[model samples]
Structure formats: structure tokens, C-alpha cells
Target: FDEDYLDPDSDINKMGRALALGGELDDFTASLKDTFTTPGSQWQYVSIDTHVIGMVVRGATGRSVTDLLSEKIITPMGLEHAPYYVTDGAGVAFVLGGLNLTTRDYARMGQMFLQNGRYNGQQIVPADWIAASTAPSAPTAEGQIGYGYQWWIPQGATEGEFMARGVYGQYIYINRADGVVIATNAADRKFREAGVSDQNIAIFRQISAALGGT
Candidate 1:
């Protein structure tokens, strides 16, 4: 990985176009420093670490993460449409936040997690990986919520309650015990407001409780 190559400032099309241009992992790591503090030290809620995971997959197998995901996860489920990775100017798959799928497709992903990585009688993602990914890795300043690997756990959530949240109020709340997956896509007037997030969480919990999950 060429640190210089990954530096967002080094290129005009850092996240936009440079990412598609595959390069050494070091370059990606170097670019990542600007994205967050050391893992577990601080919570930034940024997309760089997810991208790093993609890089890790690529480095370990010498294959694009998109291909691996398709072979291992997507194809097995026979999803009507395959998810595609967005590329940066460099042509690297935008692992951070480039995934695009319909609400039903997103619900399928949540359902897979709800099943602990098993989908349609086949084990797609490892159960252990799912557990580790949903487990809290760090606490934000609010101390109410915690972040796991690319997933979010609400404060005081029961062991089985978790969520996959995205920007612009996109969310997938899963209650394993209740067998419910609440998927929502919204355009909140206020972005990143704690109150808004808290309200949404409250509503989700209400639904879960009404369904006898809580």
C-alpha cells in the first residue's frame, strides 16, 4: 500500500475516483489515517474502516471483494439483483459506503443476520463473524450507543437487538428473538441529530415491544 497514493489530499479524486485504481494495501491504510483514530480508541462513524475490510479481503485472496461477496453471499441467496460496488477514481471498490440495494434487498440482508448468517438452508456469512461484527467494539461520546464492525447497537439493547444504519436515516433494525426486521429509509430534515436518532430508536423499540420481542 502506497500511503502517498491513498492520501485524499494527494489526489484530487481521492474517494470519488482514485479508490477504483487498485493499489497496495499500504496506500489504503495511509489514506485511512485521515478517516479515524486507532480502532477502539475513538468512534468516528466514518466509512474508511469498512473500506479497509474490503482491502483485507482483497489482499488475503488476491480477488476483488465484490467478486468474493457475489460468490459466497449473493449468488447463494439467488438475490434477484446483485449488489455492485462503487469505484473511486482509482477504480478500487468503494467499500466504505457504496452499496446500493432496494429496501427488500436490504431486508434480506437483515434477515440473514437475524438468522445468524444462515440463509435459505445455506450458511453464507459465518455465524461467528456475524456475532463479532454485531458485538460492540467501541462507545461513542454519548455513551448510550456503541459501534461494532460496520454495525450499530443501541444503548441498553438486549443481546439480540441490533441495527445496520446508514446516512440520511436509512436503517434496518433487527430483533432476533421476535423474528422481525424493521427496515426504514427516510430523508430526515435534520441530519446527525441525536434527538432524531433517539426518537427513531424509541419508535423501533415500541414496535419491537408491541410485537412481543422486548
Candidate 2:
């Protein structure tokens, strides 16, 4: 299913609510079976997965994902001015890619991950979550890229390098070994073209090298 086709009032969306409410395997498995037979067999970048993950977070905690993220991630990082998701046409927080934040705030998040989920002497996100979320778990052929949980691992990054990227040229490139992070936001005319990726990667590499990476 096209991630963009997600309807806030659709059955899947309802399933997401159920999953968020601790509905158990009967809820999650039912949803998955309706979607696919086996996990990781087919590789598709569906935004609904992250939305469902948000649901899971909401269900696990008694708070909304937005609030939880703010309490745990944003506030601690001092991103009081971060641009969160406005209501979609359907009045739901578009969890797929609806978050907006300043370049410096995004860089702070990248730096947090580069520091292994520790920020300001506090462990915000679990280190295991950071590791697993940034590690490539599926194949991305046909000029596409590898996928982690909701992150992207470019082809030739070092063992501990990955990125948090979004559509229309939103990026936070994190290089842990070199202690470098490049945060960028752009309004490009041709967003999905190879030129954008190549240019961004080139810039990231140049910046990393300039930082004196071995």
C-alpha cells in the first residue's frame, strides 16, 4: 500500500489505535497478517509502519506519542521551538514524515544518536534502540537505499554511520567515529533525483574529511 494513501479514518488507522491500546498479538498479528505474510520477506517503505510504531508507543505509555516525544526527546534537548506535526487534512498527526524542526535542532538529535542516545548526562533513547534503528535490516536495490527502522543507511557509510532523512531534502547525517553531524534542509525543485543525494553525500564526505576523520 502507498504510504501516502493512508487515511486517518481507515481500518488500518483504527488498527493502529488498537495496537496503541495494548490490544496484544490478537491486535498486532491481525494487523500484520492482513498486510503481509512474513516479516522482512518483502521490503517496502510504508509510512504506516512508523505510524503504527507510534501507536505502539502510545499504547505502551498512557500518553500520546507526540507528548512522549516531547517529554523524552525534545524537551531534554531544549528544542522548545521545534516544529511538530500540524493536523493533516484528516486532523491526525502525519507520523510518516510530518515533523518539522530547525536545522540546529535536527543536528542536536543527530548528535544525540552519535553519542549513543546520551544527551546532557541523561540516557534519553535506549542505546539498543539507537543501534537497531540505524542498522540496515533490508535490501534496497534499484537506485534506492537500505532501510533501518525509520532511518536510512547509505551504501558506503562506515560501520557506525547512518542518517535520518526525509522528503524534500531534510537530512541529518551522523558520523559517530568522527564526531561529526551535518544537518540540512532544502527546498529543491527535483527532490528525488540522484543529483541531490550525490551532492549531499559529497558534501557530507567533504565535511567529515575536513573534520580530520581517519
Candidate 3:
């Protein structure tokens, strides 16, 4: 975690080259760890932290995140297909943006959250965990957008409005007050181009409003 050696561009190249060279999976994982260790005490949003979180969960449960999620959520939710995680050379799951699920499957997760972690008459995730994770718990400025345990809350949104988001424009927006769940997946690399995210949030809000959000 050399602060001066934090070259994300070069890291991308290294990952690609390692894959091309058929390096062992452990090699990639080691490189990933080397490249993505925490930078500072600041609250920067690092995607690698997701992997670390998964490691923590695995350490606690002695099971992979994929296995836990599959047994606890995916199978019980009756998903049509099992979600997958992109893995390192050693087959360790990338717990952040590596998950791949169909739109309907994603919606099921959102609906579960909208129901306070209930799905098909059972609690998939703990209701208290849902409540805690969807609240504003980060160090963001007052009145600015807030971050919870892996969840994102738009600026000025009500307590019942929060979302799970990923790179690109993928989102599962929930408006609990209105009983609305919106799931979207996008391939827009330029999703950050001016007004895009705001527009997307506006659209979600509009949809929630149309559904009678409080």
C-alpha cells in the first residue's frame, strides 16, 4: 500500500497482463491486495473494500459470501438462476461489483429490502440489518448524499428512500413509503457525464411519486 505507488491505471494494466500471462489466481489476488490496501483514515469509497468486507464475513462464518448468499437468499427467493461472482485467479470472490444477476433477480432483492428483509414468508436478511444498513451512517457533509453499510442514499431523500448501487448505472432503488422497488442495469460507461446520475435519481423519484411515495 505504498501511497506513491497507487497507480490505478498501471494496476489495471498489471491485472490484464497477469491474466494474459496465465498467472496463478493467487497471483492476481495478491496483486489485488497489494494494489488496494486502505489509503488513509478518510472515508474514500474504495471498491476493494467490498472484497475486504467479504473476507471479514468469510472469516466470521467460515463460508464464502457466495455460498452464504446462495443458501440464505438466492435459493429461498426462488431465483431463476444463481448469481455469480467474478473471482481472482485463486477463485476468491470479488464481493463488490462482481455480482451478476438478472434484472428480475435484482428486483427480487429490492423487493426483499422493501419488505424489511422478508421474502416468500421468510426473513432473508435480518430486518435490523436492513434498517441499519439503509440509514445514513457515513461521514458525508450534512444534507449531502449519505452512505450506509454498502447502501447509498441520495441527498435530501427521506428515511424510506435509499438504494443499492454499483459501477455504471446499476441500481436497486427502494421507496418503502410507497411500496415501490425499482431495479435497473446499465452498460453506460459515461454514466457520470453531466446530469446523468441526477437524471437517473430524478426518474426514480418520479416513479416513486407516481406510486404515491410519502
Per-candidate Cα RMSD to the true structure, in Å, reads 5.1, 6.2, 3.8
What candidate 3 gets wrong by more than 4 Å, as runs, is 1-41
Better of 1 and 2 by TM-score: 1
Q: After superposition, how far is residue 42 of candidate 3 from its true place, in Å?
A: 2.4
Worst 10 residues of 3 by lDDT: 1-10
Q: How far off is residue 79 in model 2, in Å?
A: 2.1
Q: Rate the local accuracy (lDDT) of all candidates.
A: 0.74, 0.73, 0.78
lDDT of each residue in 1-214, candidate 2, tens digit only: 3332245765556655654664542344334546554776678776657767766776788776677777888888777486667443334454656687878888888989999999988998899999998988777775567788888888777877889877667789988877888998877646666577877877887898789555
Off by over 4 Å in 1: 1-40, 139-142
For candidate 3, the per-residue lDDT at 173 reads 96
Q: What lDDT would candidate 3 get against the real structure?
A: 0.78
Residue 92: error of model 1 in Å? 2.6
Candidate topping TM-score: 3
Error of 2 at 172 (Å): 0.4
